[model samples]
Target: MTIPVKNTMDKKQAITAAIVVPLIICAAASVYFFVGSLEEEHEDNQTIVIVTIVPQQEFVEKVGGDKVRITVMVPPGASPHTYEPTPGIMKEVTKAEMYAKVGSGVEFENNLMEKIISNNRNMNIVDCSEGITKMGNDPHIWNSPVNAKIMVENICNGLVKIDPDNADYYTQNKDNYLEELDTLDKYIHHKLDGFSNRVFMTYHPSFGYFAKEYNLTQLAVEYGGKEPTPQVIQDSIDESTRYNLRYVFVAPQFAAEPCKTIARAIGGETASMDPLARNYTSNMKQIADSLALEFEE
Candidate 1:
């Protein structure tokens, strides 16, 4: 029997849909792949850098701008003195072209440098603490804006070494960031000047460089990287009494109970500070402002 005209048209329409549907799908897939490839190329063009702390990430960004990607080995809220990297983190390190180490005896770097270098033999090591005078074994050099300036310069140089084509771009950003740090130094000095009680107590001695730079004293409850002993706690309390210190500072990465103990003994309270913070400029200002209030003898 001969097929009806309407039935023939329906069969033809069905055949057309089968052909058009797959063509539409293939076009969408091609676009998706093209966009994905562009994204991968963009990321591959950027230099990979590994740093030990959040502040170093900040320093690298200020100097490297959009030309660098940073991986921080010591994650946020973890103590660099005690942090151990996971297998995943070590894998990330293998992709890095540079490792910007604090190199001022930061415990994390001291313990992991040998292994990190072994993992990525091609990774160029950048000593962010280059040319800075270390305070004995103290590694909290980034607390002082002056030291931060030096660290930023080191980071800028490292970025330039790996990505020379962007050297001018990195240098411009570094100069601008250095000016900001210099301004920060002046701001801290203005906030802290003329305060009678320049002694600030902390649970950890994370502000030693800061105190040294500002001509203040950091009375730490913890001594020698150990939790406070009764004698160390008493010593901090006695120093607080002697210096008329009204606050004991506690960091995000440390135990606050020890600092609180001293604060309670002195009839004072504890304050918040983060030595390994990400927002370097604002964090340092907040620290200076906090200390200025307690410095009112």
Candidate 2:
């Protein structure tokens, strides 16, 4: 006699199978989460170390690649000139193996800063301007390509000191970064060379050094000491009209009222330029390209 073959999933058995399937999915998800966490822990433990004293942290990141962890002492949109380090910031710096000292000129007093750094005997402070030719009281050295290369060199040296095992990698990255900066500088020069007159007006004197380096002229409405008096403002207006100025460049944080006033009086338009960005290569290139366009027309 042939045995009867039954297709036999009852309602109770089908319900159990559905429930078990969901439980298995949940179990797998839990396992995956735990494995991912372990991998993240390994990566964290393997990361190289770094700290930046200023917002020029971008430079450190570029040079350090995946090896360094950098911190910016000052936050974005805050003026570094008046940024006083808190107790917490000081504590962090004391613990760091290196500090990026982009603070020079009017931003802070060197003597006081020296005392602070001296107290952190374990920390080596690398002035980003090391081997750089400075232009003015504007501590925004990272704004220029030539100065940016110097900053990259300082960063590489700091990295080697912190993680000597990665010295070759850091050096290679530093050289590559410098080469790119050189190319940017040359490209900017080529673009600006076509302009007949490089004179312009600005609300702040932040670009004094930048202008000096590129053979551009800037007459400022604001100086480090004080704002121009009413008579001076009138004179500035007259000068702008006399020179037939076409561009009035203002900084990101400055009030547009003053620039607008000057622009209206001179029959010119306005442009915004920033000198404090850490990504100097791109920022400088933008400024150079924009200025070239403004002047050429």
Candidate 3:
């Protein structure tokens, strides 16, 4: 061994190379598998959608379940009538695969539709209010559960078109949600049944569709998108008194002063109601509960 030092060193080098080469190859294989799995998981993530308002987002969630991510243009407690999307929100819209539009002449939708389409020309724009009958350009179609079912159907169709592979999944979810809507409708009917007063007063006329569905009358303080004049307010107060309205429904999105004044004039309390809440089913139920107060003995 002392006479062949160079040979001994060469043999050791050869052993080291043999060991290191296999280790490198094994490490490379592991890294490749890990990266592939990460890519697959990325692909499995939910599809992104852009909706006009919170209620539309709720509808999408009910129909799409965890398979979709929603970005709403009008946040909770914000009025869709005058919502303006920021630059960052527009950027978000560009990345979305679909836009679930209220599509019934919502002022926000009317103002931003062109820009929204331009941001993502390939994006599928689905009108959730497609089949509903309009109430003189009233865009609050989702206020009615029956109309909400139609919207969900439109949403499901849009989802199926975008992701045909998950058609069955989306369909099943839509069916389940529709059934829930039906149950909600029945519950609302039962709650409002046998009420002495079928009329309710609100500062904003967000419940036209709901009132129509339940065979009730909605008297609004604000008409034609303008604040009522003093005379008009007095007339509304007189009407409220005549109808024996117990509550003046005030939306959180608007100033409560007018509602409060009307409530004071009529000797009634102002109750808060949010038409733009993300919890669609619960909001509808709450509206029923509020209206039911008028009929209570």
Q: Highest TM-score, which number?
A: 1
Give the candidates in order of lDDT, highest first: 1, 3, 2
Using lDDT as the yardstick, the better of models 1 and 3 is: 1
Cα lDDT, model 3, residue 130: 87
Model 1: per-residue Cα lDDT over 243-272, one tens digit each: 888898899998888888888999999999
- Model 1, 284: alpha-carbon shift in Å? 0.5
Q: Compared with the true structure, what per-residue lDDT tens digits does model 3 show for residues 1-297?
A: 575998889999999999999999999999999999997776558788999989888889988888888899888878878778888889988788999998898999898899899989999999988888898978889899999999999999999999899999999999999999999999999999778679888989999999999899999889667877888888888998888888889898988898888888777889987888878998899989888887675
Q: Which prediction has the highest lDDT against the true structure?
A: 1
Global local distance difference test of model 1: 0.90
Across residues 1-297, which tens digit of lDDT does each residue of candidate 2 receive?
233322244656788989999999999999999999998876665433333333367678777888766666665555555566667766665656677777456455353466557657777677777777766466656666777677788878877887889899888888877788889889888888778878878777777666777888878887763656777778878878876787778876567677777888888878887776556677788889778866775
Candidates' lDDT values, in order? Answer: 0.90, 0.71, 0.89
Backbone clashes in model 3, listed as residue pairs = none
Tell me the deviation in Å of residue 216 in model 2: 1.5
Candidate 2 TM-score to native: 0.78
Q: Which ranges in model 2 have alpha carbons more than 4 Å from their true place?
A: 1-55, 85-95, 106-121, 225-228
* Global Cα RMSD, each model: 2.1, 4.7, 5.9
Better of 2 and 3 by lDDT: 3
